[model samples]
Target chain A: MNSHHRWLLDQLPQWERDGLLTPEAVRTLRERHAVDDSQPGVAQIVMGALGALLIGTGLIAVIGFNWDDFSRPVRLLFAFLPLLVAQLFSFRTLQRGDASPAWVRETAALLQALTGGACIALVSQIYNLGGEWPDFLFWWMLLSLPLVWVLRSSSVAIFYLVCIAIWSVDRIERGAPWHGSPMIYPLLLLGLLPFWPGWPPKRKLSVSVRWAMTLSAIVGLCSAAIFASERGSNFFGYNEHSFFWLWTLTGAALALFPLNQAAIMEPTRRKPQVVLGCLWLLGYGIAMTFRDTTRYIMEGSSFAMHLPWCWGLLALLVVFAVVALIQKRWAVLAISSLALLPLAASPLVKAEGGYYNSTLSWFATLQLAGIGITLIVLEFAGKKGAPRLGAALLSGLLIARMADSHFSLLAKGIAFIAVGVAFLAFNILMSRLRRSKQLPAS
Target chain B: MKSLPILVFALAALAQWAAPLSQIWTHEQVLAKGTLVRLKCRAPDPYDPLRGRFLAVWPEQTDAPVPDGAKIDRGSQVFFTLTPGADGLSTITSISTTPPGTGIWLRARAGYVYDKKVNIEWPFERFYINEKLAPEADKWFAQNIRGDQGIVAEVRVLNGRAVLADLSLDGKSFREILKERVK
Candidate 1:
């Protein structure tokens, strides 16, 4: 039997002896969920993934040695060798995997994808082929899609996400515009929808699958954000406000998405998506409190509604809010509302005292207040680790503002002392409230 | 039904191999039998990670007369028919979308328009070289001189396809220069 089932079987006898389960019940349960030794275990899946990665990397390195003395045909053979082996493995997996273990199929699919990339890269090496990195990655991604679709392997899907990350980064480096079929990324992502967490509800995702999904989702969103902002900044004469709004709105949506009822419930409390999203939100919030950040939006056009990304950002925010509302995710709805504040305030930033001098300070203050309130609410809702993080964020913002603000040394010192006192008083008050609640009726 | 996955895998594999192989074949064919034209070009250093390293180049400032009121649209494919100048360097005699009837011609796209001069980018602008040799090459060419003339490349043109056949500075191959410098 696979190790998971073996462990469960071991536990049942102990449970029966303890009277937690009757002997008959244990027998029935064991019979219902029969353990099959032939099925792939978690170790097998992990080992298979590692094995594929190693073999692929090894073959590429062998090719990289570049035996230039070899004849052209020999070199060509070397180029195709990895691909041939990978294809053979894939064929075997396809033939046997229906009766074989999940690991076998997953490993074979992963190897096929990796070997395809190896073929592309090694052929380029062997032929001394010169092209754009993104083009190479695009070829790899395109080639791997069939394996992902045919086998429905999560590993290949992760690999595809990695390829997209590299490709998008390269595209951005080349200063490509967003309008050049930017929708292709999301469309490509749609092909792997069946492998996502919620589909086939009874199927549980392995930890690696979860991590891969979380990471790829973040990378995909960030890439789009980067592309959109870069397009605005370079082509449309939009200032840093465009980037900030786009980034924060995307961040807020990702962070609050887990709270949505529509979100797939994970077996674990600390979902990777939620964690990543919170980090983005908090990090962006902390950044807005800094003085230099104001310069990003100050020099040029502060915020023009005419810029394409501005409208795009607003539209995305509205969509996220609408979705959150439908899901009845109060936290997400509340967080998404933060997007409107910048839209409302951007026009007001161009005031009598110049953009930075008046608007930045107020905006920073409002962001801090909003984040602080949100964290406090989340902490009360019993989100583990929120209280400490929320307090740290608030204190860090206070310290940063003090460092750059117009406050006198004496005023800053007084403010610091006051904050310290307030924290102590709040802690004392909270303890007292808890103590009183714990007390018996008087 | 069992063969479906295998068919899909084979097709995908063919596609992956076919794309680069086809590009290489076309370029190789042009390199082998295409007509050669030597043109002076100016260089800017750029590196493509997958493609190793090369110089991003532009044609030397030319006094080639534009046909009266030719619309210079950026990124639109345009052809430049080549002719030997007094200096024996290839120069654009005329620019059009249609192929020229006579001597070797270039396939280039019209870049940004400045006054009446339309900057055109030749499809074979890149001169792929060893990654290690690029920094030195970039420094050498950034001086913008080939023994009192600009750097020149012998570009091979076949039908509409162009391939960079050879890059020379002072009539010396870049490889020879690298070898000499290494010694």
Candidate 2:
């Protein structure tokens, strides 16, 4: 039996003992994994990627050794030689066709990607092209593009995303006028969007695992859009509130809209966009709850806030909100409360860069708390652990505020004890109710 | 149809080889047929993540008065036409926003004007060399470069592109010094 099947079988008895699975359920699970035994699992692909990673790191180290003692011709020969070997490996995969194992595809693609980069770096050294790092990464990303598409290599696709995201940030950091991050990053992202692995949206995948994958992708994408240029032209773009609003809107868009709009047939499907969008929205919401963080939004800046700033992104958010409203996604409707979040802070600050006394952050905190409660009521229906996540969001805000609050030491200590006691009481109540439901009809 | 994957792979492989080969070719062409100019320079050792170890070579003089009525912003690419100075090393004859139609000129990035002086960021500022030899090269450079035994960067300028073909100190090529240091 395959490892996944063996592990599933091993867990069946424990699941039965815990009443998490009936005999019928255990039998079905066994039969399901039995059929899936032929398929290569994540283990194989991870091992292949790990092998590629070691070899790639070693390749770069060897190239970084700078074999400059050799004549230019000899060094040039060395440059293409490894690349040729990597290409031959890829050719072996192509000969086997698409039915070739995942490991073969991942190793070949990743190996070729690294070798191509090493070759470029080697040639740059040979010619003494002491130019920018961003340019080198850009070229390397470009050269690896074919590998991702031709091999349908998911590992390389992710690798490409990370490199390009980094390239975008690095390119933006260069501070050239008419810099490309605002326009070009999205274009490059469009190039990789077609290759985004669709497994996360599949029905069979566990929810938490799918959420993890979605969040990983969102992290990759957000790293690229660092908003360095937001300090320039347009309204709040120059204001300190820019990144706050920008990320809030980004999260709302991802949370409300189908991330992969093309594959979004089931309106209720929990995709990366929605999973991470809520997280992004809430993540920033938590940051805004900090009195010091929110105080800087309208404080210290002498310039008066203007109307209709960040219009493009604002328009996109509005369209997504409308789409959600039409679809009756009430959980997303809770996000409308965030529109008032920054305003809640507007009156809380003392003038001129003071970092304290945003008393009204509670209003903003309340908005997020409302959203968290709504998520518990709506999205977590019969779902395990997610309700705790929603509760944690609200409870987390309460703790953060208490840490900054002016409550008496005695009061704070008593509140902590009360929360701990309440948690224990709540868990006992829940377990009792669950046990009652499982009791026989006496 | 059966050979399609191979055909595509061949194209990608050819492009990968072509990118580096083309870079090497263009640099070689500049060295071969371009006008040879020596520039007074000094080197400080630094390493690049990808390009490995090299000396960060700064030419002794890289500024000129902005041409009348020329506004150069920081990060703008400015081209400078070269003329041999009193030390027999290339110095800036004039700065222009556009490439020179003829004669030996090289492009460098501009820094903000300080007292009407335009600071140029030279493209060939990195002279990549063997990693182990860089420390000794920096040492030799520090000891010998400031005085009459200045480090002279041998450069070749073709059109507006320039390449640092070699470096020498007091009539001896840098390679010879590195060789002797190794021995």
DockQ of each: 0.22, 0.55
lDDT of 1 by residue, A1-442 (tens): 2455678888998999899999899999898667664435667767887888888777665655545446645766666777778778777777774675778777888887777677666556544454566777787887888887566566777788777766655555323435432425666666566553235533444456566766766666556655665555655455445556666666666655534232434322446755666566656555656656655544422443555655655676677667766765554444345445545566666544543645665775677666666766664775422444456566767877787789999999998887777666766765685587799979
| Top candidate, metric TM-score | 2
TM-score of 2: 0.81
True contacts kept of each: 0.17, 0.59
Task: Write candidate 2's Cα lDDT for B42-72 as tens digits.
Answer: 7888788877778878888867788888888
Model 2 agreement with the true structure over A256-354: per-residue lDDT tens digits: 663344334433444666656766667767777776665554432222133233455567667877776676666655755464356445655555544
Tell me candidate 1's TM-score on chain B.
0.84
The local distance difference test score of each candidate is 0.64, 0.70
- In model 1, the Cα lDDT at residue A115 comes to 73
Interface RMSD, every prediction, one decimal place: 4.7, 2.5
TM-score per candidate, chains pooled:
0.73, 0.81
